[model samples]
Target: MPVSAAALAESLGRVPPSCGPVRLVAVDGHAGSGKSTFADWLARGEVPVVHLDDVATHDELFGWTRRLRATLLEPLARGADAEVPVYDWVARRFGPAVRVPCAPLVLIEGVGAGRAALRPYLARVLWMDVDQETAGAAGRLRDGPELDAFWARWTRAEREHFAADPTRPFAHATVSRRTGGYAITPGPRAVLDPDFSDTA
Candidate 1:
């Protein structure tokens, strides 16, 4: 029983708003965990998605929590639109700010979206259940050897970051990549039944 993207979106729509008439959902996982693809599919419902990668820079990857809270969350929580900084990964710097319209449903997708500091504002947290080794390998392959050094450093930082403030314990659900789609299941803290679904 693979759950379709529409079904997942429907399920998300059922969640009560956690902040200012907005159901802020966070999709977190290791690098190269297929979060971007899944987020795009989820956003097909027209939900505005805020990519954490856009908020983080070479100097501050997992350290963009403060920036996110101040720039995006605070304003969104007040039902006000805010301008968010978009980082250019190629240039390793932040470019112009992009307007983040106040939406009823917002998806924040990234590696540390479920960090302890950001969880209180989230209505639901989805974890992509992919092993670090596999994710790292995929990332290396995708980014090529040019980023090997950066990946090495990122791996260490990610390990430390997760160790200090793990998100798995608080995740509402877990998503695993299947041949043609994904398998969704309730996390350890979830009380809901497993839901599988497909997405292109």
Candidate 2:
């Protein structure tokens, strides 16, 4: 069956408060996985989202956990709005900070949104069921050849990150895109993690 945003929202209502009154949901997968697209679909105006891209910088592609913690998570956890700087990839500089208000639901979508450190504060984790190679290619195609060098470094960093802190094994759900919409199923790891038994 299709995973409706309404249904997911209702489910999110049940997960324990990770960020004050907000339910922090993570949409994670390989870089080329359709995470951003899927997150846009799932959000659909029901919730606010903080894309990790805004937190990541050219100098710290995978070293953005600290930035996220300070700018996003910390404030949200205190039931306050967060002012996070947006990184301009082209300029290689962080732009003006953006305010993200505290809401009932929040989505964090990116490759490492479900990292070990962030998982504890997440109400639920969703992994895109796409291979790294395939996703990387799609990402490259979307971004174009101009980013070829960046993609190379990105792939290596992503591989290392996932290898050390695999998010798929801990995700509560797995999402796949179909022609019409997306199909969401219980993650394989959900069965083993007692915390996810309700969804499993």
Q: Pick the candidate with the highest lDDT.
A: 1
lDDT of 2 by residue, 1-200 (tens): 45566666667777678878888999999998988888887788767878889888877878889889999999999999989899988898999998888987899999899999998788888899999989999999999999999999999999999999999999887887765676677786552123323332
- Residue 199 deviation, candidate 1, in Å? 18
| TM-scores for the candidates | 0.93, 0.91
Model 2 clashing residue pairs (backbone): 32-135
Model 1, position 123, has a per-residue lDDT of: 89
lDDT of 1 by residue, 3-36 (tens): 6777787788778887677888899999998888
Which residue pairs overlap in candidate 1's backbone? 2-196, 2-197, 3-196, 3-197
Runs off by more than 4 Å, candidate 2: 191-200
Once model 1 is optimally superposed onto the true structure by TM-score, how far is the C-alpha of residue 91 displaced, in angstroms?
Answer: 2.8
> After superposing candidate 1, which stretches have Cα over 4 Å from the reference?
191-200
Each candidate: what lDDT? 0.85, 0.83
- On TM-score, the candidate that comes out on top is 1
